[model samples]
Target: MILDALFFLVMAGLNLFFWAIIIAAVLSLLTGFGILDTRNRVVWTIGDFFYRVTEPALRPVRDRLPNLGGIDLSPLVVLLLIQAAMLLVAAIQGYLIRGGVYF
Candidate 1:
């Protein structure tokens, strides 16, 4: 039962991170296109919030990947990593369940 709960919590966390990455990506584009103004304190605050939440996860990916001029693929890679983590957790849970281990 504890393992199951832990798995669920992990999945939830990964989902949240996945959504955060997506939101940050869109916001970045909007800001770059001038659709979203970062000059306003409110806008800046909001943008900073997203950046703080995502940068830690994204920084390593960004550094390792080649710079593609104005294009950034780190978020896509992060999303893929998030999905992979969720799948790996689910697979472990499945294996434990099949083995008749404690839930």
Candidate 2:
């Protein structure tokens, strides 16, 4: 029971992070399009917040990927990785529930 709850918690956290990456990407787009006024304090604050939250995860991926001139694919890669992690968690939970023993 506890293991199931723990797995759920981890999955939820990963799910939240996945959405954060998407939101960060959308916010960047809006700002780039001049739809979001980053000059405004509120907009800047929100943008900064998302940037601080998502950038750490994105930085390494960005470093490894070749530059694509005004195009960023790190967020998409991170989202896919998050999905894979969630799938791995689910698989572990299923294995435990099926009486698989740890070696």
Candidate 3:
């Protein structure tokens, strides 16, 4: 029971992070295209929030990846990794269920 709850919590957190990455990427695009004005306090605050939240996870991936001018693929890579991790968590839960380890 507790393990199931723990797995659920982890999956939920991963889902949130997954969306955060997507949102951050879109926000970057909007800002770059001038669709969103950073001069606005609300826009600036939201952008800053996403940047602070997502940058730590993205920084290492960005640094290791070779530059492709304006194209940034780090978020896609991180999203893929997050999906892989979610799959892993589900697989572990399935294994535990099959093994009768979850009750």
- Top TM-score hit: 3
Model 3 clashing residue pairs (backbone):
none
lDDT of each: 0.92, 0.92, 0.97
TM-score for each of the candidates: 0.94, 0.94, 0.98
Query: Which digits, one per residue and each the tens of the lDDT, describe model 1 over residues 36-72?
Result: 9999999899899999999999999999999899989
Better lDDT candidate (2, 3): 3
Model 3 lowest lDDT segment of ten: 1-10
* Model 1 spans > 4 angstroms off: none
- TM-score rank order: 3, 1, 2
Give residue 19's error in model 3 in angstroms: 0.2
- Tell me the tens digit of each residue's lDDT in model 3 across 1-103: 7897899999999999999999999999999999999999999999999999999999999999999999999999999999999999999999999999897
Error of 3 at 23 (Å): 0.4
Off by over 4 Å in 3: none
Pairwise TM-score winner, candidates 1 and 2: 1
| Superposition TM-score, candidate 2 onto the true structure | 0.94
Clashes per candidate (backbone, < 3 Å)? 1, 0, 0
